[model samples]
Target: MTMSVTPKKAIRVVVWGENRHEQINEVVRGIYPDGMHATIAGGITELLGDDVTVTTRVLDDPEHGMTEELLAETDVLLWWGHTAHEEVTDEVVDRIQKHVLEGMGIIVLHSGHHSKIFRRLMGTTCSLRWRNDGSDRELVWTVSPRHPIAEGVPQPLIIPGQEMYGELFDIPDPDELIFISSFTGGEVFRSGITYRRGYGKVFYFSPGDEVYPVYHHPGVQRVIANGVKWAYSERERESYLVTPMYLPGGFDRPVLGSPDGLVDYYTRELIEPRENAG
Candidate 1:
């Protein structure tokens, strides 16, 4: 038997950030002068370069930095939000979910677990526990080592200092549970998860603490870049069926092809609230 391999496809990724932390937190500012999105996008550019096209978007921008046109062009969208998830309009969230359903990849980072789109897509409360004492040592455990999203991951990579997000993550089962995290204080979490929604892939990674320099970590950056490439799908899936045309005026129905309820004017395809409903 022969095995099959997929050809390399150029991934188009947009790293969307709220940009509030960089402005409000000196530590965050010191880590990413250009903003978290820029830092993350820089890593993607450095890692994938010609293999991927990375862009940055922020919440303050018009259309909240994600217009329908831009969403359509983006093969994968990376989200990082803190202190401003509420600022993201539901319209944009709807567009994002719709695009995801149409096969666009999505990578939700850190606090983005509570992002409107993430909650909507997952249909869960998307809540978690956390502590801001800055005593948490994030030891991210590598679970799905063979998954492309975990391609360059090192087991239990340590973030010496950061905010601890403890969890009984409220969400549905993911297609693949990639990386889990066990904090130094004895809290366990499903820190990374991958799922398929509609025709697209989705991943949630908990990192990039607002007060820590997580984006600078080589392992974290590698995972983000790999995730961008992994989540994207090459082909779009069409679900709606087109109805058949009516026969010419009064043409005699063929005996074998009688119009006896066999050929209807409309075809019934399962219609979801969102056209690209996953």
Candidate 2:
């Protein structure tokens, strides 16, 4: 008798948070006592359950908790940063970029749009207008109702309080625009967008501002969990270096033979001779 083997491993996710605000600000700490990374990771675990294995990483960790081995094992990485974007080293940014191109999925949350990895992948300023007096009401509308990231998301994700992030969001047009948000101040923003770079998938959802309790909102948590699930890569290969593929030859082109011998096969039926042949 033959026993069937499982087809795939559990989805691996790493939630990376700056953790600076919680360290310095009492209010932020009160909102996310275990740090935003932990809270985000917990939310993903709650939503995905046994299908996903979620872990937390922070800016203070060595190499910012993004060691080569860790990234190699991470199928999806969620990034959250606010105050310490510049403190992230160029070396780590390069590492993240390399892995992303290799097929790892990335979810850039809120202020992470300004992070180095996000900017490098986007090849743009990744800038946007914003305001946060802490009293703004945000209604995140599902623009693409059928998107995977919007599978269980509410029609208009209502957050009673959140930092207002308005547009002209400076970035390339997204492969998919999943959500648009409007604030009480009448400012609208593209709140959820998705992109593709090399073999990887990226999703940016702008709602988890550090100063507010946005991360704890059930709708926000569900959206983030859905984003993580949507961004997971299913490809077989996971290396950045791609080699050229060989295909059938025609016309003047000949199939490759031993390079040293440089032997050439000739036949009219196989490859028509040049019109100038004499």
Candidate 3:
């Protein structure tokens, strides 16, 4: 028998930016006058169109613009933080972590590898070698062409100028490695990688440095949009993914907790049941 599936509505996306450099550095400001988060959000909208609904948030916003209500409505979140990772409070990081565990997708971009949320999920220092002389060229080689995040992405996509991120990246092995980037300095790095945390997906793409107009590159934009799409979780949002107790012959239903007494799997009843236990 064929099972019918419901069509998905538009993907809800939140692009979170540090918005620090643009406010202080002239070059970064020139590259992204409206803040990198806005540019990133625009790119997702431009590529996905009606398939996605994108919104921008920044570090300066109240609660860093990542309230519980906002995260509940967000299917996927894109984080771009650079100089202010610590400013992101532990409370907000805790919330984001919980949401991710509950099936909210996240795309951590560039310097966001050092962000609190990414590191918390990664359980590593998430450190890597890097240079920012603005003289390096980046060629993002698509190592996994068939990967969903590599869709429409050109082979060896070139960026005229970028900061170099070298290897020895300290993190757990990625679930998938989609792109490897080679810099002019003869350094190579895993530029595009993915991971799974509980029911949520994570994508880390290290191309868009704020000093360079990498976000304006069509190839990079396409890759980011594809990452957003691939990272989205179709499962209904949950408080968390919990281990449920199931009774034999009642496999269709799952009991979240057995507060009163132990459940008898064979008999499908409670052992030493409490007076008010249902």
Candidate 4:
């Protein structure tokens, strides 16, 4: 007998960006007239349709595009940052981290690997060697050939003319590494990696080049769409493993406590600090 594969649930995504390059650089403006975040949201909207909702936000917004209220309502957040990573406020980062710990999915693109959320989740320096000459030809090798993220792609597909980001990227080992990038400049990068901190899943995909139309490519969009589906859980289940107080109220106490100890709500599992802030 064969079992049926369940249809994937739609993941709500927030297409977020620094939104500066479009205004400051003519090339970027020409490539994505509506802004990169809008373009990404367009791709996701086209792919997932009514099932998935795609919304856009920018750094210059009232809360730098990430507010506690907005994050509480977001399921997945796609971050695109280049020159304005430092401009993102610490408070916004905290809100995002809290949501992730509770079970949100995060996708970081290109230059966003250095963003605060990525660094905090990975718990590392999050540093990498890079070059912006814009001549690098990246061969995106789908190493985990059997992984869900590579489900429909040909192995070692090429995305010409990308920025080179070289490792040893100072990040905690990813829970899974979906793709590796080989550049024309003879540099190799662990370009696509995934990690889970608390109940959330995080993915980092490196394809968009600052001056190139990489994001507009259909293949890139398909891969990211696939990733979003892969990152979603079978059902959005609560993260906590087990708790004593969860037992039915007014239960008569066992005469000898049937092997289980008394429950203490005040004494609970401590979460790892979302940031290494002093």
Best model per lDDT: 3
Instruction: Count the clashes in each prediction.
Output: 0, 0, 0, 0
**Which tens-of-lDDT digit does each residue in 1-278 have in candidate 2?**
99998876789999999999998899889999999998999889998898799999899999999999999999999999988999999999999988889889999999999999999999999999999897899999999999999988888899998889999999999999999999989999999999999889999999988878888888999999899888898774355554322335645544323323322342213222344232
lDDT of each: 0.82, 0.87, 0.90, 0.78
Q: Give the 10-residue window scoring lowest on summed lDDT in candidate 2.
A: 259-268
Instruction: Write down the TM-score of every candidate.
Output: 0.82, 0.87, 0.90, 0.82
- Cα lDDT for residue 103, candidate 2: 88
lDDT of 3 at 159: 94
lDDT of 1 at 238: 34
> For candidate 4, which ten residues in a row score worst on lDDT?
253-262
Name the weakest run of 10 consecutive residues (lDDT summed) in model 1: 253-262
- What lDDT is obtained when candidate 1 is compared to the true structure? 0.82
lDDT of 4 by residue, 186-217 (tens): 88999888888778889899889768888888
Q: Rank the candidate models, highest TM-score first.
A: 3, 2, 1, 4
Query: For residues 106-215, could you state the per-residue lDDT of candidate 3 as single tens digits?
Result: 99999999999999999999999999997899999999999988988888899999999999999999999999999988999999999999889999999989989999
Candidate 1, after superposition: displacement of residue 155 in Å?
1.5
